[model samples]
Target: MGIFTRSIVSRKPNESMRLIVTTFFGVVFGFLIGLCFPKLSLTKFSLSTSILTAIDFKYTEYTKLGPSSSTHVSHPVGNNGSSANVTLRKIWVPSNPRGAERLPPGIVRAESDLYLRRLWGKPSEDLTSKPKYLVTFTVGYDQRKNIDAAVKKFSGNFTILLFHYDGRTTEWDEFEWSKKAIHVSVRRQTKWWYAKRFLHPDIVATYDYIFIWDEDLGVEHFNAEEYIKLVKKHGLEISQPGLEPNKGLTWQMTKRRGDREVHKETEEKAGWCNHPHVPPCAAFVEIMAPVFSRDAWRCVWHMIQNDLVHGWGLDFALRKCVEPAHEKIGVVDSQWIVHQSVPSLGNQGESLDGKAPWKGVRERCKKEWSIFQTRFSRAEKAYLKEINSTSR
Candidate 1:
């Protein structure tokens, strides 16, 4: 202490003042740096170098990326044989104009439904009851009696949706249930067309299961509540009530079995099935009465071709939507419906070159089946090629 005092006394007045000012500023600068990075110690030279490097990196990244964007960094080799930087930025999902990154996961509004909401009621109290399941039928006015009977088979828990191909929506109002039901009217359009447009996965996501059915089905022997019970009991994600063995039965797998509650497989004609797990023999249901669990429908909705409205070959490929599909897809034997096989939609087609409208419709169905199979095969091949290359 005595030596420092003597040294300060020996120095010129201006020099002493300069040393005091320099020391004071140096201490203040270090204290401010400490406040900025409390975790980084200034005493350790190695740690200080690391801290400076990190600060430089953050400054460069923030300046380059800017606000309103998030990035995922990846390292890939460039054509010049040097490591290149890749930035994956946020993108807005079509359903949300605000961008998906800003929202919580799974909180998307892409799903919607046919439930009627009142303008005067609070949003939470709008619906007296939220239906757990959905049932849809494509109808012409001629099938009103059958559809009326069919709707009765489903309990109050099911949301009834009717697609009118004959443009007679108001006529269905005669039935008491129609007052509560959702009706979509479009002349000469098929069920698949309505399904693609109206029954979007997001729209029907609230329902536990969905029934896409033919209007001509005789549901006298079928009970939807019981059908849902059997579906859940068997862990069936994709299923249908068994088609009555007596009429309109195309595949043996879907034929009603009297002995069992549910059946997942059937014996097919020789060479009809390459494996027991394949379609026709197993994992199969006719489109007319196919019922899908919510998760299964999401996948199936995407597989429906927009242009191929007939939905002829969809039954064969539906197994793609559910894992271990043979087990997950089955027919509930306890609840069976008779397919009336009415050609109402086919009759809507215009007669061409003196050919019957129905015949042309049948031809179109066959053509669509061929096109779907070819497209599916090509897609599988392309996906496999991409996967193989990625693995390499």
Candidate 2:
């Protein structure tokens, strides 16, 4: 009975030890199988989420889809002996939209065919802005060198119109700077004739001043910018530069003195007289270089009779434009141009009916002066009569 009892106790301990050893070996074998075939799944165990993310990151080439691969990836696809069911997707995106229409004359309106533009280059409903000065010169082929030098003096703020009398572009177009000027090469017409035809008062009403200059001027000492500044300062409506004293100065008012701003009144000698209506002390400038104000030019353009192309009798009668002609019409002494006195145009006077061109021109000048005097007297009497009748 004692021996059987001892045997039972020893058998029970041995069975317990055998069960523990079997359990440890089974656990070790399962862990080894899991490491070898990581993708393999069982009903009881699943793959680690960190391991799945690391695998996805390693295969994706780090394309930065949101913050993590799991953010855009679908549900973990089961590998049931078939290919993994995977889906490529983008994260959430916001919408982009256009703005509202508020303003008129939009791109569509401006591009419409109904638009009428006022621009000289391309007409639109837009108004035009005119330049400060309109400078016209009657250029001959022989005096192109002089014109080149004169154009250099301008600051390029004014418009230059060149009327070519000789009508040859070979000499004038040879200069590189002539491309900037508006060259009008016409045949058999004088400067005044061209002025009458092209430079109508209403067309040039946009400019503040008009410069009708001759071609034979030496502008070595002259600066157009400074001349404009001085003209505005002196309040001159009709003005010209003082001629070089040594050159041909028929009128004393146009003579350059010893560095003065202006010379409106010349001194009277024992024999000379200062007439209120005459030049030298009155408002007058030579035709060689005359700068007229817009308002004054409007008046002067009307007084220039259509038949009187010589422009003689015009300088003396310029007081009709501005009443206080002496104050408004004076010579600028600060900036002066040299009259080259080149006789290119002077020698071109021709007569078709056996009379010399110069002789015809001279005779016409004398006749125009006489006619202007008679016309002035009639105008003055008419004005007086009107004033007297109005007073009554």
lDDT of 1 at 226: 89
Pairs that collide, model 1: 111-202, 111-203, 112-202, 112-203
| lDDT computed for candidate 1 | 0.87
Query: Each candidate's root-mean-square deviation in Å?
Result: 15.4, 24.6
Give the clashing pairs for model 2. Answer: 116-124, 116-125, 117-123, 117-124, 117-125, 118-124, 349-357, 350-357
TM-score of each: 0.75, 0.63
Indicate the worst ten consecutive residues by lDDT in candidate 2. Answer: 96-105
Count of backbone clashes, every candidate in sequence: 4, 8
Q: How many Å off is the CA of 48 in candidate 2? A: 83
Best by TM-score: 1
Error of 1 at 8 (Å): 98
lDDT score of residue 312 within candidate 1:
84
lDDT of 2 by residue, 1-392 (tens): 99999999989989999999999999999999878774465422544663676475455433333433233443444565343435433222122112212211122221111112443554443534334777888888778778888887876567778888888866666776566567777865667777787777766776778888888988888888888888889989998888888886777778887668877767544345457545745677888888988898889888887777768778888877897877888889878878877766655777858986777767777897788778878999999999999999
How does candidate 2 fare on TM-score?
A: 0.63
